[model samples]
Target: MSRKLISSGSEFERKIGYSRAVVDGDYVFVSGTTGFNYATNSISDDVAEQADQCFVNIAQALEEAGSSIARIVRVTYILPNRDDFQPCWPVLQKWLGEVRPAATVFEARLLDDAMKIEVQVTARI
Candidate 1:
């Protein structure tokens, strides 16, 4: 099996040394992606907005990796505040509820204070 790396054109990937997603054999593993719109380099302060953006980023990475958001097999969410998690449920459900992939949410400090959420996913090609 060959390996392929996907990038979302974020300079952070180059500076931090990471691919937005990696493809190996039958799987695509997306890295922890934040709310920043890679194109605009803008992030919403609202948690729900951030969550919505996370899905967008994930979907793009998955597609580039020959998969789709519908193919996600697992999802991991990182939040700076445990309290912010619930507010994001609607957005999350809208994206992944039907797919029903294995999911988890964690409260941890992110690299940026402005970032409220980071999402990572794994999918099969």
Candidate 2:
């Protein structure tokens, strides 16, 4: 089997030594994506907005890997504050309401203080 890398045109991949996503056969694994506006390199502070952006980022990566959100098999959400869960849940539901892949959420400090949420997803192409 062979693996293909997916890039989001971000410099962080070179600095971090990891691609935005990687596809091996029918499986596509996306890295933990933050709510960042690549054009400005800024993260939104609103948990709901951040969650939405995270999903968007994951969706883009999956698309590049020849997959889509409906093909997602699993998802993991890391949040800086547990309290943000309520606001983020609805946003996630809005994007993945029908797909409803296996999901998990954890409360922990992210890479940065402004990063309220980060999401990782696994999908089949």
In terms of TM-score, the best-performing candidate is 1
How many pairs collide in each candidate, listed in order?
0, 0
Give the 10-residue window scoring lowest on summed lDDT in candidate 2. Answer: 36-45
Query: Which segments of candidate 2 are over 4 A away from where they belong?
Result: none
- Give the Cα-based TM-score of candidate 1 against the true structure: 0.97
Among all candidates shown, the one with the greatest lDDT: 1
Q: What tens-digit string does per-residue lDDT give for candidate 2 at 1-120?
A: 589999998788999899999999989999999999876778887989989988888888998889999999999989888899888878988888999999999999998898998999
Local distance difference test, each candidate: 0.93, 0.90
What's model 2's lDDT at 110? 91
lDDT of 2 at 87: 84
Q: Could you tell me the lDDT of residue 82 within candidate 2?
A: 89
Instruction: Report the C-alpha displacement of residue 8, candidate 2, in angstroms.
Output: 1.2
How would you encode candidate 1's per-residue C-alpha lDDT over 1-125 as one tens digit per residue?
69999999988899999999999999999999998888787999899999999999999999889999999999999999989999999999899889999989899999999999999999999
